[model samples]
Target: MKDFIKFLRLDSLCGQLVAIAVLSLAALQCVNYYAVYSIQQSYASEFLSVGHDYLASVCQALAHMSAAEREDYLASLDRSRGALAKPFRFRAAEAPEWETETDYYKSVLAREAVTEILTRAGIPPRDVRARVLYGDSPEASEPHFAGYVFPMMQMLVQDGGGSWLELVQPLSVTDRRLIWRQRIFIMAESLICFALVIIFIVRAMLPLKRLGESVERFGANPETASPLPERGNYEVREVARSFNKMLARVQRNLTERDNMLEAMGHDLRTPLARVQLRLDSIEPPELREKFAANIEEIRSIVEQGLELARSLRTSEKAVPMDAAAFAASVADDMAANGGAVTFAEAADCGEPPLVAARPTCLRRAVENLACNALKYAGGAELSVERRGESVIIRVEDRGPGIPPELLEKVFEPYFRVEGSRSRGTGGTGLGLTIARNMVLLNNGFLTLENREGGGLRALITLPALKTAKIGEIRS
Candidate 1:
């Protein structure tokens, strides 16, 4: 049922409006029809009563008249029939023939209304009119009779002089035509009014469209400020104000969290530095070296945690750098320092890409992967690839790979693979976590996985940008 309603467009604003308009039009038609029908019925009843009364008046006058006077009265009645009343029509019957004088009176008095009146006067019409009149010489013709009855009498007039009367009440042509025209005009006006209302609603809803756009942008890029207009209808303005307040609260909370992490990492580093100094001052040479080594490793861990916090705090204002060349230089520097790190352009590379990033932060990320590989895998191969809208810097090695189950655990602070955090390995176990935090702060992602045959592969993907045109490059 929900799907059917969707297909019928019932959920949309425009569809609801059209449905309301249709129901209103149907209601209007019913009301118009009933009102017109009631008025016509009333007019018909009144006209019918008036016609019956007029018929009776004419019948009474004919009954009291002499033969010569009756002929004159019939002619006058026929003439006056045209003008009897408004919205009524009348017609007189033709003359009749009889074989005898008594037959004429009998036929005349035997008509429905005439017999009724004569019977009341103690006369039987059938006894008087006994003969049949064959009017034509060869062809037989039906006899005609005349009678008068008023509108109220509801009876007929019968006589040889003027026989049949027709009284009719028909709807006026002018009134009927006007009624039809009015219905047509109402329909036309309704359609036009409905169209106007729809247009007004759409225009009024424009502000809501803009508010929706603002909401989507706020969700998409929370770090950027987009102030919503506190204007338009009351509901719209209220929504805008609420959205702005929410954005402000989210930004403040995030900022405060980053600051707290930075402060804790900074305060811890001072004590760690003091401990490293004390370890160096131990009396026994071999024991002092071992103790010094332990304290320095602890200090390195502290520094890496501080770096991660700082990366998050500074990424929003980080300076831009050429990401491709920067990655290559880090690899070359590690190799020069006696680490087995090799740098090469990818087969699918283009001119170096630029990125909105901190050079020091990005360099630290690539350096951490190289050092991790040199420590465990003995060497690593580094390359930069330019993908659509992104730069992918990969560091791959050939050594015992990290266990599949522990792949994600390696990036957690102070986490190391089982048996890989030995003092002989000389690692603080915070390198990969720091690298990942830096990558994330720069609006990128860093992934770690085993290469096809053996060893770990770390790939950092950053949003790609075009290299600056000549003068646009910063020194």
Candidate 2:
């Protein structure tokens, strides 16, 4: 059942709509066929009812006539042409053969009606027998066309001389051509209905598809993503409008928060500077050193907090850059800043290792990782490689790795491992959080895992730009 649903693509709205339309059409066709067949049967019964008197008169004549006269009369009826000709046949037999069983209720009703007609013709009902015949019956040689079968009736009556009279007539005069025409008409109507239904469904769902795309883009980069257009039905337009309103509100809130953080940093830095200037009046050298260190820590916390806010709202445009060269530059910069960092050779690939990203933000994220590794593990090694459609930039170190349980918790804002909380470690606990945010801003992923021997590995995976060429590099 699962495989069948998958094959039909019933998980999607369009597939379900088409399936329902087809099923409804099938059911309608079945009902139409039954209705038409029932109507045809009703017409046949009415025809038999209207012709009962005429059939009784013929039976009366045959019962009284001699065998020779009856033969002449039947020959005259057969030889007559056009409107004068009767659409029935007569014959003489020694004994009558009546059908013992039949599946059609209409056939049983036809037999009973014919028996009543014979009784009215002065013939004994016990000596009269009747049966209904379809095209499949051996005694029925009725013409068939276009796979349609015709039905007929046969009746037998005993005469005074022990001879039997046989009569045959069509049950109904339905046109074979007419049945085909009706079927073709039904099929064409069903097809038109199905087409109209599909067109309406697709048009109705188009706006929803666009809305989903806009939502995904906004989630990836809300600062740059455009608002969804309010077009389509009333409900769809309303949804788009609501989403645009929410997006604007979120952007406004973010702007206000960033501005507040910037103002706080500015307001707190001036007072801290005044305090640092006044620290020399403490007299004792050790106490003076402690006061200065505490002031510096406070300054560091303010700067890191501002940095975290800024990372959330970067406006830098992304461009294609070689991932290998990018990693090399970051490693070089970190080393020049007196941090032990090494750049490893790029992995061999047929094409240039390019990725689309905001260069400044990506650099900041990688620098944060390298700096963290340097502070705790004393050194860091950076490497770049292309893995399928993604470019990986890894910063690894050889130090006591984080506890397995705290790996993900370390990425939260202001979260620190047990030993790294002291001022000597020199972290405001926002470095990893800010770094992850910066990477996410450029549609990249940042993850931390424990190294095999004893260390932590920070991996950044960015989507590789296959369309970028070496000539397109812009420093």
The TM-score of predicted model 1 comes to 0.47
For all candidates in order, the CA lDDT equals 0.64, 0.78
lDDT per residue as tens, model 2, 360-448: 99999999999889988999999998988898999999978899998899998888887754346888789999898888887887999
Q: How accurate is candidate 1 locally (lDDT)?
A: 0.64
Assess every candidate by TM-score. Answer: 0.47, 0.68
Could you report the Cα RMSD, in angstroms, for every candidate shown? Answer: 14.2, 7.0
TM-score of 2: 0.68
Query: Best candidate per lDDT, number?
Result: 2
Instruction: Provide backbone clash counts, one per model.
Output: 22, 0
Candidate 2's C-alpha runs over 4 A off are 1-94, 99-105, 108-128, 132-203, 206-226, 332-354, 381-392, 420-423, 452-454, 463-475
Please state the error at residue 239 of candidate 2 in Å. Answer: 2.0
Query: Which residue pairs in candidate 2 have backbone atoms (N, alpha carbon, C) closer than 3 angstroms, thus clashing?
Result: none
